[model samples]
Target: MKSISKYWSIFQITLINSLAYPGELVGRSLMIIPFMWIFYQLWKVTFSAAGAADGMINGLTLRDTLWYLMLAETIELGRPPIARTMSENVKDGSIAYILNKPYDFLLYQFSTAMGETIFRAMLNAVFGGLTVWWLVGTPNHPEGFLIALPAIFGAWILHFSINAMIGLSAFVVEDVSAFTWIYQKLAFIFGGMLIPLDFYPQWLQNIAKLLPFSSAIYGPARLFVTPTLELFISVMSLQITWIIALTFALAIVYRRGLAQLTVNGG
Candidate 1:
């Protein structure tokens, strides 16, 4: 209970700190507007070109695609760059200060990352949602937001586990930009960030769905589009499985990194 309170206080402080520069927060969020607009134009052309009955491609209509894209963008753009931040701390040896702190390092990072995520994601949702709504009317399942909420949170936990593992690599490599770039591209392609997995060929869809990246992006975004109980269960089940697996992997990596850790400076 006391330990939980300490992390909760850390979360609260980071949340408040994120709001300190409202202009920067809002400015960064505005990038989602152009992204949504471009998606609208590109997908409009795509739906037109495909000429699928009633503007539908695969299982999704144009409106559904737009809404899905909006949520996908919100998830991608909202989270803080945890890997890069941790890498910087490692490179500068500032992690020594953090190691001296009382709280568990992983929990502390999760609390702070989530605190930073809340407002950015909300703003991205507002801007991206309005843009998508204007491009195509309201989502078919407005209640899907409520339904997909848990999965969205789980998505971030999965992301943090993976990215933290990547960050932990910096203890040895001291630079992780290459790994970060590869991870982003993998997520964009395999995670259905650019196109829903349903649109993919059957074999590819099967493979992509099995990946943690899909659970982080595609699962929640798809749930937000459809929001059936079965999907909610499926998404959460996959997410929990990935979260548990990746979290254990992260712990192993963290322990190894600590043994290998070499701070460059005082």
Candidate 2:
């Protein structure tokens, strides 16, 4: 308990430092605006064509598709960019100091990442809210906001855990940047960032749902269009399951990695 509290304090300090860099925060926040606008235009064009041919694609009207894209863009931008940070720390030997601390390194990282994620989420929500209003209008389903809160929070946990696992590979690999890039591309394709899962083929959609990537954006984005208690429970359950599995797997990796570190003393 004391160790956890100690790490939490450190994470808080890190969170404050992250916020102190206003220029970096503003730059990253501004970058998302153009990406959101590009996606909005692309989806608008795609939906216009699809709606003309078939009347609707995957049960979504052109309006619904735009809203889906809006939610997805916001979620994608809001997700913490932890993998690169972790990889750099490990490659530079900063991870060794973290490991030597009395607290669980992964837990400390998780806490700090969560703090950063919450801050980003709030910023994105404000920006996204205004953008959606101006572009697509507010979501028709009022209940969508209620469902979104829990789903987004669960999605954050799932994202953090999976990223932690990927970052942990730096203990073995000489370069994790390539691997992180691959994971990011996969997430963009399969995680419903570029397009909603409903637009994918049935088998691909099924496989995507089974993967941790979808929980990051798709599940929460779906809440805005088809908010339901059952869907919320199901999405949250999947995220919880992934979080537990990844946490256990990371624990094993940390134990073994530390043992190797002790043996090498390098």
Best by lDDT: 1
Each model's lDDT comes to 0.93, 0.75
Tens digit of lDDT per residue, candidate 2, span 79-129? 777777777666777787777766767778888887676666667666766
lDDT of 2: 0.75
Candidate 1 TM-score, true structure as reference: 0.98
TM-score of every model versus the real structure: 0.98, 0.89
In candidate 1, what are the lDDT values of residues 95-155, reduced to their tens digit? 8888898989999999999999999999999999998888789999999999999999999
Candidate 1 regions off by >4 Å?
A: 262-266
| Candidate 1 lDDT score at position 84 | 98
